[model samples]
Target: MSTRLRIALDAMGGDHAPDMVVDGADIARERCPNVDFLFVGDEQRINALLDARPALKAISQVRHTADVVAMDAKPSVALRSGRGSSMRLAIDAVASGEAASVVSAGNTGALMAMAKFVLKTLPGIDRPAIASMLPTMRGDCVMLDLGANLECDADNLVQFAVLGTVFAQTVLGLLEPTIGLLNVGSEEQKGHEAIRTAASALRATPLARNFHGFVEGTDIAAGTVDVVVTDGFTGNVALKTAEGTGKLFGEFLRRTFQSSLLAKLGYLLARTAFNKLRQRMDPRRYNGAMFLGLQGVCVKSHGGTDGLGFANAICVAVDLVQHGFNEKIRKELALLQESLQAASAAASGSDPQAVAQ
Candidate 1:
């Protein structure tokens, strides 16, 4: 059997459709020569795009499908009527073991719904969390529940922490990654009961050696922890706010530089430094958001990203597959379960027994 990784692509799902998807595949192919692709979309459109990239054509196969899920379609509607859609077909490829992973720049809700229905959650996981790497002061940090579960309980938060920890170790190559719960303050008494309970559980587990307690919003950029754990609601809001702040900062610098002749001349002198800053802040470098805790690998690319951004998403999938991400998660989760059960048993034993009447 061939050891090469095969990835399924939803070629008709993005704003730019087959063109961007095909071009991205070409870029990713160049980077990962051993990887093959199965493109699911309108065969004619995909072939037309591939005509210009003979190299990509040699490593890719097209699975024809004319149906596409609309960008604004409700998840329920897509689930009910999108059986033949490109996104669903691409996910099906993974479920059927035809591909190692699936990538799509499609409707977020529809993609998640379809993927969950098709691939199902990993054993011992109640829900899959959305995880992505963020550029931090120290380096990249993994954050989870990025708009996946809006209302998570203490167990869910703990589960997300385990998922994020495994991601950091597998993808980031960290030996012992530190984790933190995102809260308003770092004190033990702060935040909701769910977060506090999750914190206590983490501290009592094997993960406590690397757990950094609670961290605030500033800690995200400061890289206070290797992983940041939170509910989907807070994580989504934090991600958007950080994105907007970065854009605003860029705009402010642009206006400042163009304010006068002297400022423009100063900018020219610092052009190299500014270029490095631009590269560091480029969103394309971090375009892929992984659906962690799934039985199979699924990466969601930004719907409006360009070929380069989509290529990064493809790279994320390939890395997850090669690194044995899901297997690692399962092993870690099993250990976590054992530790929690043992702790529960100890607590029960310590409680006084009721007298027989």
Candidate 2:
């Protein structure tokens, strides 16, 4: 919070890169004069985009580099040969201390691989998880390992819940964030061994007092849980399902309204209300993906993301920096781990499953 936050942006890494990344940068600079931005990508194309648009001409220039790692490129291979690739450079910039944060929409695997190499995990963390915000009925919950680590054990899940609670507090500003082990049912014995063991450990920890019991998929948006911890396989499935469902629902609504004049009139009257709802629920609004459990905050947007989306991701990274997200995660997890150990010692003679249920 003491220093100005500068974000290194991978301009060409997303689905809507360059334009989206550029526009988002412009928005951030205009909104917060204190926040500076640096874009990493093709010099000619980036300058051309800036040149063509008077709105962005006044902002900072792109840090020119020709290396580009295709979305499908292997993470290790990309790490070595990605060279000047915008994503690689952006992360490297952060590692070198030239940048406070990095934002990209490029390859998730590559991003995670590169980030782990550069930032490394905090002392207690085994791997950094990709945490994202999801709409919940009560409000929103931060879900982790959305796609970073595919096979997570009980310890990994426990770590996620701990770190996720820290994230919810720092970024989401939620005090005493409720942590939950994502499962198929609410029963204590619902999930596999990982869930069962993690639940027992979390509940036994002092911080476990802050953690709630198991939650199901329906609770994701109902806001029944503040933080949802699961393996990347499940988290990824949930994320994609939410996105697909939203898109399909939106398309359905548009199509239905277009079929008749009456529907059109209704849409017109509800346009503002609809837009408000859309903005609230839009993935674009919550576009940034956080690399949790790292020394610094690194965000990955959708590769095809536009300037606005990538820029928003940058803004998210800056916000994380300002909130001391990484430090908070370390502190909170230490507390949780200590609590777990003490509780274990005290209950060495007690029945765990009995206590858990």
The whole-model lDDT of each prediction reads 0.93, 0.83
Which candidate leads the pack in lDDT?
A: 1
RMSD of each: 3.2, 4.0
Q: Against the correct fold, how does model 2 do in TM-score? A: 0.91
In angstroms, how far off is 281's CA in candidate 2?
Answer: 1.8
**How displaced is residue 109 in candidate 2, in Å?**
0.9
Regions more than 4 Å wrong, model 2: 51-61, 347-357
Per-residue C-alpha lDDT of model 1 across residues 2-117, encoded as one tens digit per residue: 67889999998889887889989989998987899999999998998888888888888999999999999999999999999999999999999999999999999899999999
Q: Compose the digit string of candidate 2's lDDT tens values, residues 74-179.
A: 9999888886678888888888998888988889898888888888889889988999988877888899989898999988988888788888987789888888
Off by over 4 Å in 1: 350-357
